[model samples]
Target: MRDSLRFYLGDELREIRDVDPTLTVLDWLRLSERRLGTKEGCAEGDCGACTVVVGRLTEDSQGGKSVRYEAVNACIRFLATLDGCQLLTVEHLKGPDGALHPVQRALVEHHGSQCGFCTPGFVMSLFALYLNEDRPDERRIDDALAGNLCRCTGYAPIVQAARAMHDLGDRTADRFNDRAATAARLKALADEEILSVGSGDRRFLAPATSAQLAELLLGHPDATIVAGSTDVGLWVTKFQRVLSIVLYTGRVTELRRVADTGDALEIGAGATYSEAAPAIAALYPDFGELIRRIGAEQVRNMGTIGGNIANGSPIGDTPPALIAAGAALRLRRGDATRTLPLEEFFLAYGKQDRRPDEFVEAVILPKPAPGARFRAYKIAKRFDQDISAVCGAFRLSLDESGNVAGIRIAFGGMAGVPKRAAGAEAALIGQPWSEASVHAAMAALKADFTPLSDWRASAGYRAEVAANLLLRFHVETTDPATETRLVGDRRLAHA
Candidate 1:
């Protein structure tokens, strides 16, 4: 077992030891390294002021190692998660000649910064985009900047800078372009040893393999499992809770994989939304749209579906959609593994069916049937970076005679758990696809859930929106001439 953590801080390898288990990457950057560029606006992951790029080693088609860079909220990210990866901050963007990086240059040229509080975060986000995409559209630009909020300057200038990046031409020859050397360094640092750091009861363990993780969990069942720190980070920052033993799943390479098995799509428990978006989109397009609005690019890049499921938050955007689509979860403890329906995993509000010493292994989603029609709707105050007030997902199949063959309806934020609307499903089954049947199911929703009123929405509002979403889904699916979606309306107008 390695007793210390090693990672790259902009081409320089640093080894860390005897650090607090709950120490955040942002704190270490400003306090220890004295790199003051990354600022902390919200200690939670909501704000992008502390945005930084993390690069992990990935294999290319030719079996050559390359680095995949992703923008993450450093304020919520733990320092221990940086082991065997490259950390790129705002200060690392300059060339050897002190020339500003293309993203930095574009921001300056476009006047994207004012008061300069959020500039570094924006620059880091743009840098990740610059590395991944040659030219990004307005939608992509907007998605990248969604987590970042500029109070003084509007998003117009920042968006201008995002587009201006494409005008800089080919950037493969840039100073930070080459990943071969960094990949090699990271690969050398990678090992099967468990990285155990910190003192006494307060420690962080990052197991390198799934087997190791299972064994560690079996031994230390009380340890908090942190994948992305998108949620757990808040325990320390907002709640001021000190985690004693944190078993990080970020280093378990097997858990980060996404696989297609013909019968089902298997998304590893630690796979980020960014990694699983394509597969989820392929299975259900509406789910893809819902995932896009989960928490902007930064949150999506870091948050995992497994973490979302394991956390068991009723309002979590993915649970309702996953539950409605008949997704199952693979749970692991020691060498034993068990599969359970996703809906059954949530027992109540702030409680899950997960047992001690067990952790989520993967989410298995069966391929949609031939006649399946799936739709997921997320209703929130803001279109981006906002929690859902109510999330509804519907999967309906029609028989040869145009009757409702099978229907699965689920909702989040309507009750204590992300649960299926059993009463509503019963109302729709074997019924003709008509307004009368839709109304019956809509009425049945009231029987299934007695929603609680909160700041995001009232019970009456949620109940009404839930019913309206069903109506909207029916109209879009049944009526060929009717366009209920705004996007569809625009397309029809253009046509």
Candidate 2:
């Protein structure tokens, strides 16, 4: 069966399969559908101008929640991957009898718009904020909208508008729950095969089964695997990569599940970070902020945790965290499958230890010790959406006497691939959590790595910071009295 685009547009549900898989949602919204509310400021995912609301089916404890809305940048999002989801635009933010949405009214009253071009995207982004959770903190608001960049009106009034959304307190009164209607339509749509779009050179293919997917890929090995297209979409808008053979994974349900076992937590490769993150964050609170900063709520909602892992960018926020947790990958081909450590999966720069015919199916993460101490840190130019200069994840277990029992330290943006600080780990393995031991282990920094002198940070700076971060971790965990929790103290008790 063929996959199709299923989303909400104003009062009606839109089913779109008329464009190539490589085409971005921004183009579809503006050109094909003529929905101008979603703007394109920076073609890349950076600027939030192409923000649009995407509605996804959620599984609630009660049963199933249909079409939950979120604001995402349409610019770097592939249109074909939106199958079995709902997409909303600013024009649809209405209550019964033409009542204005809270975000719209608040923005209007606060004069949050100066150029008016950015207003629609900002409003939609805020509306997604309004729908997902109520009474978000300042940090949450900033993180939720960080992908969006605006020049006019600064951010004060816009921030004011974000806060006002909570007080209105109404739960989308006019928002209809067309669960049966939407789900049935989507069900009917996905129950077809050999789906193709466009008449001329522009075309897309969304195969239903992995076999069919592989067959298409065999013919077009250069075909793009567009699950969420968060990164690849950037290639088109930012770099203008003309993708010829595009494959959509949203139709392949085999790659979108999360499962738990006694030994490991198994997550499908196509499972979005939004879907897989909460479970992971629960297991490791140290990664809460990291997952939230993976992108905005929209990107998280649209992007997959496995996609982030598969993309294998040094700046990817999830890889360090996963490596720290001792995650493994499940790869599959036409009929055979295999599993391997995720660390071994990355061979080198722009390379993976993957078979040409095999693609990642899922990732299995071993459960950490209940008493183990954990931390993941991303040092970037900006707190969100910015590439990391040095990303670190530290996991430590201590003996009763405060001697290190076991340790795993992983760093991203420090080498050609995400690497473990083997020297640092060896230094702390048998040593007590004493200052002198930590000081001695700092010497391992030189042996472990010689980081690149990138624009993010100098090589010497990276080495110093990496060493000190370990010492700081030791102090906080082993001797709280020695660590100053205060920010101004500058005693540096963080990693």
Candidate 3:
């Protein structure tokens, strides 16, 4: 065991013994490091003013390890999770001779700054994008910058900068391209020793293996398990809640994998949305599209699908789709493990079937049956960086006679939990796949859920939208040429 944290801050090796388990990276950067370039806009993960780049060693399917860089919001990311990774801030971008990085240079040349408060965050985001993509189209550029908000109303120039950044210079010539050296440095910090450190009432324990995590969780059942910190970080910054015992699962290698078995897909509890998107997209295209809309690039880069399920938030965007796909949850307690249907895992709002000593191991999603049709819809006020008011998912399979043979419908934000719409499914099963059958299923939704009125949407609106989404799904699947989504070519018409 080691009572310290080890990571690379820029090219410098930082090995500190004294650390705060709940202290956010934003606070440490501005206070301890005196690096104010990374500003705090929302203090939550919504606004991307605190965005920074993190690089870590990632292993491919062939067991070849390389460094992968991604942009994350530092405001909600705890400092303890930085173990064995490289934390790069805006201040570290310039060369020793004070030459601006290509991203910064592009922003300056294209007049991407107005008030300049959010420029650093934009630079960091563009920096990560530049490192990862050799050429990013307009849609990709927009997706990369979705988390960032420019209050100065200067988005046109910023977008132009994103496009022109590649023309500035070759990305391979950048200092960060020395992947071998960075991977070696990160590998040096990797070890099986558990990290135990924190201030007075706050304690942090990071176990490198799943067995060790199970043992620690069994000993301290109440310990807060933090993987991405997209939601937990908000408790500290917005609510000012002090976490007593924090078990960092970000370091556990076993929980960060996504595997494709012959019959089912096994997604580790710590696998982020970005990591799992490709595999999901291949199986269910519509479901994969919903993942891109869950949050901006930063949130998707950090937030895990398992954390979304483990948190048991009814408004989470992934549950409805996963439940509709007939996924199952795996829980582990010490050496014992159990599997349960994902829908049954949620008991009620703010409550889950998870035991105090059990940890979410992985989510197993069986391959959709042959001829299965799946669709997921997220209804939010804004297209980006907004919580869902009502999310609905549908899976339908018709028999040779053109009647509904197997069907599963699930919804989020319509009830206390991510629930399967049993009544709706019953209304459609064995019925002809026609408008009458869809209407019956749509009407059955009211009996299945009585959603509450909230700021995002009203109870009546939720019910209406839920039904309309089912209708839209039917129309799209039945008539493949029909245009139901307005986001495709119609977006530019509004401009």
Write model 3 residue lDDT over 1-495, tens digit each, in one string: 999899999999998888989888999999999999999999989889999999998887788778889999999999988999999999999999999998999999999998999989999999999988998998899999999999885789999999999998789888987888999999988999999998776789999999999999999999999989999999999899988999989888789898999999999999999998888878877778889898899999899989999999999998999999999999999999999999999998999998998999999988888888888888898877789999999888999999999999999999999999899899999999999999998989889999999899999999999999889888977885553445433331100
Off by over 4 Å in 1: 59-64, 481-484, 487-495
TM-score (C-alpha) between model 2 and the true structure: 0.90
Q: How do all the candidates rank in terms of lDDT, highest first?
A: 3, 1, 2
lDDT by residue for model 1 (1-495), tens: 999989999989999898899899999999999999999999888779999999998656565668999999999989999999999999998878998888988888999998999999999999999988888888788889889988998899999999998676456766677877778789999889999999999999999999999999988989999998999999999999989999999888789888899989999999999989988888888888889888868889889989999999999999999988899999998899999999999998998888889999999988889868888888888878899999999888999999999989999999999999999899999999899999999999899999999999999999999999889889878875743355321221101
Q: How far in Å is the alpha carbon of 296 misplaced in model 3?
A: 1.2
- How many steric clashes between backbone atoms does each model show? 0, 9, 0
Candidate-wise lDDT, in order: 0.89, 0.74, 0.90
Better of 1 and 3 by TM-score: 3
Candidate 1 local Cα displacement, residue 36, angstroms: 0.6
Flag the better candidate by TM-score, 2 or 3: 3
lDDT of 3: 0.90
Q: Cα miss at 377, model 3 (Å)? A: 0.2
Residue 57 of model 2 has an lDDT of 59
127 Cα displacement, candidate 3 (Å): 0.3
